[model samples]
Target: MSSHHLVAVDWGTSSLRGALLDADGRVREEQSHPRGILSVKPGGFTEVFETLFGDWMRPLGTRCLISGMAGSKQGWVEAPYCPCPAGLSEVRAKVLEIEPGRISIVPGLNDSHDGVPDVMRGEEVQIFGAMALTGLRDGLFVLPGTHNKWARVKNGMVTGFRTFMTGELYSLLSQHSILARTLDTSAPLDEAAFLQGVTQSDNGQGLLHNAFGARTLALFDRMPTRELASYLSGILIGEELRTQSVHAAVDVVLIGSPALTQRYQLALQAAGTQARTLGAEATWAGLHAIHSTSHRKT
Candidate 1:
């Protein structure tokens, strides 16, 4: 049997994160790199890993468990997705071994709701980690990012979920679209303007019409020139919460960076909803949990 530690990875589209864990599953060291799946040359994943962790693993070769885009088709290896309402055991059973059971990739979750398929990778681990850490039996869990995810969880398992491209759209419209010219990108959010957008989402006017309001608001000087971006962002996030929160329990679990979560918490509050923010390092906790239970030979 090997005495090496476990290395947990959260390799997403734009970044790669590695954590070296001791036997007790506590992270002893952590490393992050910008070499995401999209940036790595085709079939060069091995080289990239060596560049990032070779020296760290030199002391004692570590068994690795990877999640996120690293398991997608575009990633190092395509670990097949497990169908939802899935638990960790099911996800674990499908973990793909990249090196004779030594290096493994965690499988993402897939759901077909109303014939529309959706999936999430790294978030699965974080969501389950929050579940294990908080001991919450059921609620709505949100992971805010480029593609915001809203998941329905029950009894420590993910029942179903949906994804929204609100962040991506904001970037596109704020940076490259015509609206980009009318607003200051670096301007801080105007809470009043943002809340106004949140309020507008419920006016029965649909997103299409309301999105246009970003332009109209600035055109008419209805909102401050510097605050246009914030108001726009609010509109998108506000609408996302409005539509999805209805399917959620009274209290929603909001996850992600503090800045983003705070915005969500406020939006949630405005929507007459309650949210509990989990400040733990969810992905690491999740990977640690999986590694603890796997107990596979190195």
Candidate 2:
């Protein structure tokens, strides 16, 4: 591992990004492309990777660790999920080596809720990275995206987690549904309106009933069209929060983009919970940690 460099990649559905890291696990360079797995033709991953990252891999002994959809059945190569209760060591053990020591894919994690199955690909890396950065072996973590995830970790391992379609639902209701008629989707965040929706969600009427209020509020001019989008966003996110047992005494770690995390932070505050945030750096640290551990074992 002394002379070798690492190429850390996070290839998801809509885009791909990578970093060139030195032996010490510090990022030396970074780049991204809009060509995500969905955009690549079948069996064309090699071509795409080479086109986007060949220069970084040209140096001898450089290894690449790819995470996310790039390892899914629809991507370059299928890396089976590593079942939950997984830690860094468990994940490292299950990595699918595609080119011996030159490249490998980090397997995603699979968990179950009741009888329904839930899976996450790249979020596992971010969770581990958050742990590495925060020095907390156990806590609750939330990753907000198209599909928001709420994960619980104990003793440095993910015991289980749940997923919510909060973001997708917000998009649908705000853009595709009848509510879109009055929504100013491009309006900036209206904190007051958003919080109003959050509060409305806890009214015991449930989401199906609460969501419709967004349209009615706008129709009757009770709420401004410009703020309707934020209101709708709050209702969905607030519903997601309703499923969790957030305690004021406990802190939740949030890993995602600023916009999403900021919303989660505000919602959590309303629930009397504290939140800490980590961004893309968590993914890099998680990849580097696994790469370093795997190399040290050899």
- Which model scores highest in lDDT? 2
Model 1 alpha-carbon miss at residue 240, Å: 0.9
lDDT of 1 by residue, 1-298 (tens): 2445877888999998888888776778888888889999998999998788776566545688889999998999999999999877778888899986467899999998789999999888988888877778688889998998898888878899999998898899888877888878788767888888888887888888888888988888888888887788788888887776453444488888887888788888887787877654788888877877677622
- Measured against the true structure, the TM-scores of the candidates, in listed sequence, are 0.93, 0.98
Candidate 2 lDDT, tens digit per residue, 217-237? 977889988898889889989
Give candidate 2's error at residue 131 in angstroms: 0.5
- Going through the candidates in the order shown, the clash numbers are 0, 0
TM-score of 1: 0.93
Predicted structure 1: lDDT: 0.83
The whole-model C-alpha lDDT of candidate 2 against the native structure comes to 0.91
Per-candidate local distance difference test: 0.83, 0.91
